[model samples]
Target chain A: MDIFLTLFINGLSEGALIFLVSSGLAIILGLMGVVNFAHGALFVWGGYAYVWIYQMTNSFILGILAAMLIVFILGIIFEKFFVSRLYGNAPAQILITLGLNIVFIEIIRLIWGNTPIAIKKPDFISGTTIINGVTISHYRILLIIIGISVLIIVNYILKNSKTGMVIRAGVQRSDMVQALGINIRLYFTIVFAAGAALAGLGGALYAPLAGNVISTAGANNQILAFIAIVIGGLGNFSGTAKASFLLGLMNAFVAWFIPSFAVVTNVLVMAIVLAFKPEGLFSEGRKSILRLAVKK
Target chain B: MKSLREHIQRDFSKNVIIALSVLLIALLIFPKFSSYTMLNLLTRIFVISVFAMSYDILRGYMGFINLGHAVYFGGGAYVAGILYNKLGTTIPVFILSIAVVVLYSVICALVMGKLSFKKGTSVFAAAMLTLALAEVVRNIAESWRDVTNGTDGLIFKVPSILSNRIFFYYFSLIFLIVMFIILRKFILSPTGRVIIAIRENEQRAEFLGFRIENYKLIAILVSGVSAGLAGLVFGTFNRFANTELLSITYSTNALLYTLIGGTGTLYGGIVGSIVVNVFQNMLLNLRSIHPIFERWLIFLGILYIAVILFMPKGIVGTLRHFIENRKVKSDNEKSSKTEKAPGE
Candidate 1:
């Protein structure tokens, strides 16, 4: 029972981080039709900023907030400078984003010198809490709460906000949105920046969870985010959240029972998902979308 | 005489002659310019260029960016490495190894293709799947150390026939040239035209009665076969195969080469491969001269960005544009001279 409980919490915490990173990716892909491979770089930059700030100021909240703000600014700059030029061409966008990713990853390595930095939970949340004969770290439980809170806030904005409405309309048809006197190009820029900020937030939060921040981890997280987005359905926020949770649980369970299977399990799941629903679990309307596109 | 000249002009006879001459000269003189070590390095580059060509068949012709292509190439290397260790050095074993790798690649392709059949999975999704699968394969290769020789990487005595670095370089060059010929024939063939059409518009091609999936599958298979051949050559040349060869870097390198060479032209793949390899070699060699130049990844990233922004059409495409422009200019000049009126 303890083992199961521990696994569940661990998985949930990991899933939360995955959800934070992937939601940004899912939203950008769904609404703007831009596959930002540099999302991973944002995550990496966020972590590095947090660590740098924390080392300088020694205040966790300030460090994290500063990091998030930096990422937000960087995201906006990136959209304006780089992503703006690659609005419609996916292959070119992918190449540019990949190039940006390499530059960011290398910069991190150059600055940090390839050494893993130690990341600790703030002193206030440093202790463990025992409940129902199961011991859970307080920071981990905090992670779950934080994840839920962010999800609610984001979902609320996505569903009810005026900008969210614009995003939905743009997703339906970029040209039609422009026809309606809305500048979708501007919306796409804001969306990319927002996505970067969210990814930054996820990276900042994940620092303590993983106990270290490293350069290559962004690539690893990027892969995980991609897998999550694909499984959950490429533009669906809810689907990504659910898929992240399921994958997290799956990894935790596999690790406990058969540790070797933990890595392979993700690939096996992807293969199965690809076989069963190539459009993904939530891509119900893409067929019609494709048909409409073809007619045009 | 005019009709004969026109026929010769339309046939690409001159272009073929120029390309072959350049290739022949490079193959013969490259060894003399560089030492044994450099010869070996160039040979590896040639093999990898062939691998990039494999990727080009899928990415350029079939319009499918397969992220998992290293599986076949790496599989062949491992197969050959294992075979060389267990069974004595025999040419037949190399052939069998190639077959085994091709079979493995085909099975993997069928599975990946079936899963991604809906609107043919997005480039990002395919890349993610392949990256994940490569990691899985890497883990398997690591854990199954008994067979893979684990982190040490499987190494064997160099094959007697290819013991001389120059001999191996020449052999690989021949293999690359032959593969290029095959690829040229494929791209020029009716089937190749259909593949190109699918890349332009899959639904339209399907409406035009082409079996889109079947063609994609065949393209993938041919690509796998080429990768397998490259892998066999790589294993023989390096005398070892490691999990690194099956990494995301390998896939990325191939992708980068295709992008650099100009995917629209057959020779672009070869040019891209050579360019990147030469650049890398120079960077590594000059590390002592400029310590900061050790950051090769940064340079490569900048290069990728530059290529994407300025040379979107790639090297061959740019060259073709210039050549066509010159021809047009000459034709205009000839026409102007023939005209008697000043307005003309």
Candidate 2:
């Protein structure tokens, strides 16, 4: 019972972190049709920024805020200058983003060197809380709270706001959205930037838990994010969230049982999911999906 | 007197023969003139060129961008390494190793193709599936300590003759040239025309009564076999097969070389491999000049971006396009001149 309880929290917290990163990826891919391979770079950048700022100011809030801001600005610049140029070209987009991923990792290496840097949990969230027979860290609780809040906020914005409506509509019918005079290009930029910010936030949140941030962190997380989005359905936010949690739980359980195969389990799950449900679990039965499935 | 089209065809064939003879002569004499290090680099280029060309068969001809192509390359290398280590580098062992590697690659392609090329799989989904599958292979290579030695990698000896740089260099060159000829022949055949038609427009090709999936499968199998052969040569040359061979980095390198040289053109692989390998060697040699030279990956990244933006057709493709344009212009001028003279 105790093991199960611990695993539950472990799974949920990990799933929350994954959701933070992958939801952004899912949303951006859905709306903009760009894979954003460099999304993981934003996550790593956030972690590094948080560490650097935290070391200087010794304030967790300031560190997180600074990290988010820097990544957000970088995301905007990336979308405007780089991603905007390769809108309709899938191969070009993949290559450019891949190159950007390498560049980002190299930049991180240049700044921090090859060694991993560890970050301390904030003093306020450093303690552990015991519930019944199970012990959970304060930071884990905080992470869960933050994850739930972000989920709610993102869901609300997407459901209620005008910009959200534009994004949703644009994903469904870009031509119609453009006809509606919504400045669809601007919306794409915003969506890309917002996605980057979410990835950045995920990085900042995960830094303390990860203990150390390395250059490979982005590439590592990027794979997990890819798996999550694929399993959830490429463009479905809710599906991504649900898949993230399921994958997180599976990961935790697998790691506990067969430590060597933990890393591969996500890939296996993705493969299985792809084999069974190519259109993903949450995608609507649109003509595009049908076209993708049929050999014309 | 031949018709204009027949004359053009004869001229093109003649030019091709001349170009190929020159390349063969250069490769044959290269080892005698250059240092051992240069021979080794050229050998690497030859092997990589074969790999890149194989990749082009899928990416350029079939329009299926496989991001996990290194699985076959690594599969070949590992098979060769393991066989050489256990059974000794006998002629039979070498042949067996190559056979196994090629078979492995075909099977991998069959499974990956079935999963990704199913009716509704998008380009991104297919790429992602390949990436995931490669990662899975990498993880297995890392964890299967008894066989792969778990990331420390396996280093084994090849045949005594292959130990000599000159002999191996010639061997790889011959292999590359042979593969190039075979691939070129395949590309010019009727099946090749159908494959190109699919690339140009898949739906239209299917509507025209072609079995699209079967042709794609054949392209992928051919690609996998050639890539496996390249990897077999690479393993023999390096005498080491490690997880890095199976990683996304190597796969991306193949993509980079193919794209930089030109996608659809046969010789694009050779041109791209030579350029990238030479540039990489130069950068490594420049480490003493400045510490910034250590950051070569950044420069490579920038090159990728620039290639995509300005020269998407790549070096060979762009040059060919320019020459073809000039030829067309001259032909038009000549036709107009003849017509004017007749009128006058």
Candidate 3:
């Protein structure tokens, strides 16, 4: 019973991490209609920047703020210079983003070397707490809190904020939005920057849990985040949330019950999702013309 | 009797001759000037270019962004490696391996297509599904220790297919040429036109009474077969097969080649492959000059950004655009001259 409780919390936290990283990707993909493969690299950039700042100032909050800002600027620059031209070209967008991802990862290797860097959790979030006879790690609880809080904040921004409304409008009809005298390209750039900031935030939050920030880990997680979006339905926030939790919990429980099955769980979940609900659990409206590009 | 300039402008034969002349010169000096170090680089480029061409069948021709494309390539590698190990087979195993991969991909495509045939699950969702499925396959290969040899990977003595370096180079060159011929023929065929049609408008194609799903399945199968062939060749050259070969990164590389070369063009695959290889080689060499340049991957990323933003049509596409513009200018000039000659 204790083991079950522990795994459940563990799964939720893992899901939260997945959510944090993928939510940014979902929003960026939704509004921009551009697939940013470099989003993972952005996440890595945030984590690495956080590490550098942490070393410089020894203030975790300052490190996170600086990291998020730096990555956000980089993201905006990426969109302005590169992603703008790839608006209608998925293949080129994918290729360019992938190359950027590699570049970001390699840059980290160059700056920090191959050694994995660890970020110490704040004393407040450090250690474990006994909850209902199951000892839960405090930092994981903090991560969950932070993830949920951000989700709420993002939801609020998308729902009530004017810019978010513009994003929704852009996602519906980019040309129409542009015709409305609003610069859809500007919206895309902003959304991409915001998404990058969110990804950086997620990475900063995740640093403690993962214990180390390895250059390749961000790319690996980015691929996993892609899986989450696929299973959750790309461009659907609620779907991404549910899928992340499902994936996280499944991974946690499976790892606990059958260690060998842990890695396979993600693929199995994706296969099941693809087999049963290829449109994802919360997919709504018509498929994009980009999909029509596929013969099927 | 037109002058050389007028005749050249009037006929496509002149352009073809010019292009072929450039190609012949490059190919002739390429092997001679390239030493062992450069040959190795060239060989790697050829391998990737072939891989990219395989991807172009689906991505460039059929307009499907299959994120799980490495599955076909990786499947070919594993199957060929295993068969070679068990039967001590050579090229025959490669053929069998590709056949198996095609069968596997066809089945997978059929299933995936059926589920995601709806309008909403078109682009990112479909590609994501394939990626997820490939990851699952990778995990299975990693876990299936008995057959795949687990994460430790499979290593074997280099088979005597083409022991000498020159022979191997020549063998790859011939294979590439033959494959290019086959691909060109396929692209010019009626079925190929239908594939392109599907890319332009699926609803229109469906309305025209075409079996869209069947076409997609077939295109995917062909792509899988080609990827398998590339993978088999790669395995033979490397003398090993690992999970990394079946990764998303490999798929991304192929996608890069097709994009940078320009989609929908006959020689886009070749051009894109060459560009990526040359760029990569240059980056690797740069690493020796400045250790900090080891992070050339970042430059690659930035380069991709530049390409997407500025060169959406890619190198070949840009060239074609220039040629077409010149043709238009010449036609306008001729029309103006004809107008001036009122008596004629």
Q: Which candidate number has the best TM-score?
A: 2
lDDT of 2 by residue, B166-253 (tens): 9888888889889988998788777888999999999999999999888888888889889888988899899999999999888888
Candidate 2 TM-score restricted to chain A: 0.92
lDDT of 3 by residue, A47-148 (tens): 888888888898878988988999899899888877776567676677677777777777778878888897787666779988779999988887788888
Q: Write the per-residue lDDT of candidate 1 for residues A1-296, one digit (tens) a residue.
A: 89899999989988888888988887777767777888888998899899889888889898889878888888888788888887778777777888888887887887787889998878888789888988898888887888888889888888789998887777668889899999988887788888898899888888877888998788788888888888887767777888888877888899999997788887788777876776666655644221222122
* TM-score (C-alpha, index-matched) for candidate 2: 0.94
TM-score of predicted structure 3, chain A: 0.92
- Residue A140 miss distance in model 1 (angstroms): 1.1
**Between candidates 1 and 3, the TM-score winner:** 1
Candidate 2 scores a C-alpha RMSD against the true structure in Å of 3.1
Query: What stretches of model 2 exceed 4 Å from their correct place?
Result: A169-182, A284-296, B1-16, B342-344
Model 3 docking category: medium
Residue B218, model 1, lDDT: 72
TM-score of chain B of 1: 0.90
Which stretches of model 1 miss by more than 4 angstroms? A170-184, A282-296, B1-19, B29-33, B118-120, B341-344
Q: Give me the displacement of residue A130 in model 1, in angstroms.
A: 1.5
Worst 10 residues of 1 chain B by lDDT: B2-11
